[model samples]
Target: MLAATASQTIGPYWHLIEDDTWADLTRFGAEGETVVLTGTVYDGAGSLVTDAAIEIWQTSPAASDIFPAFGRCRTDSNGAFRFTTLKPGPVAGLGNAQQAPHIAISIFARGLLNALITRLYFQDEPLNETDPVLSMIEDEARRRTLIATRTASGAWNLDIRLQGDNETVFMEI
Candidate 1:
């Protein structure tokens, strides 16, 4: 009989299995409104998690042969990650409700039992007011955690906090 081996967590060495091209969703000549999303990951102690891996999934505005609808990026020494992709449109939610345009995010890091799930929404999008998920978050401050701010250079910025006074709102699934 074969004995079961111990399960291992995905650690800082994820880059070993990561493809460099996975960081850019527009690599195959996808045409649309392209934007850059940038952010940093912080741990419970407020220190940077320099080796976390972040994955984002979003439906494109239109059918495209180039857009893969998913991308992955590894945090740098400063815990920063960036992705270049097209802006997504609002999607249908449960019971005929519409969800705001957003990107679904999954974060993998050292010391984590499982990947953290979250969503990133654009700050200036008016549709955010009626988004089913956003509306469900009663705490205004906590809801803000899911919104990404537009930078002066036209990039969207979002910071993820594992824990603290400003901990980000992570989804259960």
Candidate 2:
């Protein structure tokens, strides 16, 4: 008789997402409004988590050879990561509803037993007002944590806090 092996933590592999090219989803020449998504990761104590891995997926342009709609990035010493991807558009929600334009993101870090999943909603996007998912959160402050605000350079910035004060809203898988 055999039993399943003990589960192990996902990774600390530097080779996986180290390639700078992997951080650029637009490398395939994806068309549309291309923008850089940037952010920093912080630990529960509000210290920088310099060794986190981030992955983002969008549904707007759809996945394809020219537009994979996905990207992976490894945080730098400053706990910052950047990805070049097409700005996603609104997507359909569960049955007869519309969701605001958002990018699904996951983070893999040393302390996490599993990747933390969250969605990045655009700040000031009109659709956010009526999106079913956004409407579910009545607390404006907590809900704001998921929003990506545009920076002066026109890039989207959304910081992630693993815990403590301004913890990011990670969703259950």
The number of the candidate with the highest lDDT is: 1
After superposition, candidate 1 runs with Cα above 4 Å error = 1-8, 62-64
Predicted candidate 1 versus true structure: per-residue lDDT over 112-168, tens digit per residue: 868899999998898999998899899999999999999956589999999998899
lDDT of 2 by residue, 21-77 (tens): 888988978778888899999998888988888999989878998988888898889
Following a full C-alpha superposition, what root-mean-square deviation does model 2 have from the true structure? 2.6
Full-model lDDT for every candidate: 0.89, 0.87
What does the lDDT read for residue 28 in candidate 2?
79
What are the clashing pairs of model 2?
none
As a whole number from 0 to 100, the lDDT of residue 46 in candidate 2 is 85
Candidate 1 accuracy as lDDT: 0.89
Deviation in Å, model 2, residue 147 alpha carbon? 0.4
Candidate 2: what lDDT? Answer: 0.87
